[model samples]
Target: MLKIYRNTSIFIFLVIIGVQWGFYKNYTSEFPNFIGKTNIIHIHGALLMSWLVLLIVQPLLIKTGRTQLHRTIGKVSYVLGPLIIIFLFLIGKGSYWRAIGKVPEHDILRDMVLDSRGLISFAIFWALAMLYRKDAASHMRYMIATGILAIGPGVGRGLINSFGLGIGTALTVTDLIALAIVGFLLGYDIYKKKNYKPFLVVFIVFLIGAFLWQVRDSDTWQSFAKSYASMFY
Candidate 1:
């Protein structure tokens, strides 16, 4: 189970990197623009990548019977997790400011709301994983849920750029991908442990969050988002 998740994390990390590269074209002519972003972008990217690398390493440590090392390294998330949330906010706010007139109002609202939900989900799952640190099953499951939550933007971007899907369609596809992952986890729990409580909770949270994201462009949400953006921008 641990090995499966570890490998899955690796695959997700690769996918995220590929999506980022594709969307930003940072490796090509856009490298200067990408590297010249405000310090917040650099910090956010570094912390996020560090977290992903830690996720991949922690499981490998456990699989190799280096429990002590794993625990030691796991402590890093206490700092990295919060930093990730903070930087996510900063990045999102920066994006909102930059898109004020250039991007459509509906698209901006949708992105802000979806980004907020992802941040909330990450914080919740990270806290739960910490609280259940002693319970390997619950802890690992929460961690995996966090990973899934963190990948939404990447998945959405991949869908948009790779398939030429519209933002709305891409977001819907990402939501389905999240549902499928939770469904698989639920099935695994049912088959192996005869208990799916953890994944059930995750599924509910994910569904609600995705729904909120889908409706971000509603009149009520748009009003709120405008007010919120005004405060920051």
Candidate 2:
């Protein structure tokens, strides 16, 4: 079981690297314009780069079984993890709002309250991860949650560039792709391993439900936005 976990961690780390590389290559072209538009863009970009580097290096530390070093860094990671997720959430909200040209029956602005399911799900998962800090299973679930949480934007950007689906279709399709990949991972694990990993199942189920709900629930999202406003104010 330890061996399987170690291997899975390594595999996920590499996959994150590939995802990062793709993200950089695909989106760096917009950095100049994006950065000029909002200071949030620059901060968000720097943090994401750091997060990606940490993701890649973290498994190396774990692979070497350097528990002390890993634990020290893990403490810092616990704080930064949610911050990164929040940054992504805000950025997504900003980007989607700016992109809506012709509002349909519903579009990014009308329904995008608090980044909807994607970001909210990430926050909850990361929160739970910290709550379960003593459990290895819980920690790993948070890592997977972070990976999938970041996946929506990564996959969305890739899809928009590669396929040129219009605005709503592009985002919706991209999110669906992210969701699909995560779903595939969980389903494959359960089918092949013949066990549903509880921690993973909880996070994934939360994500899927949030994703579907945010996309469809405009009024609820509006209420959610007001709630987010109240949090900081």
All candidates: CA RMSD (Å): 2.6, 4.4
Q: Which ten residues in a row have the lowest lDDT in candidate 2?
A: 105-114
Which lDDT value does model 2 have at 29? Answer: 62
Model 1, residue pairs in steric clash: none
- Candidate 1 per-residue C-alpha lDDT over 1-233 given as tens digits, one digit per residue, 9 for 90 to 100: 66776676686577567546555543233565665578888777778768777877788888778999999999998999899888888888888878889999878977788767777788888888899899888888788787777556776776676778887787887788888889988998898875588789889889988788778778988888888777865
Best-fitting candidate, scored by TM-score: 1
* TM-score of every model versus the real structure: 0.87, 0.70
Say which candidate scores most in lDDT: 1
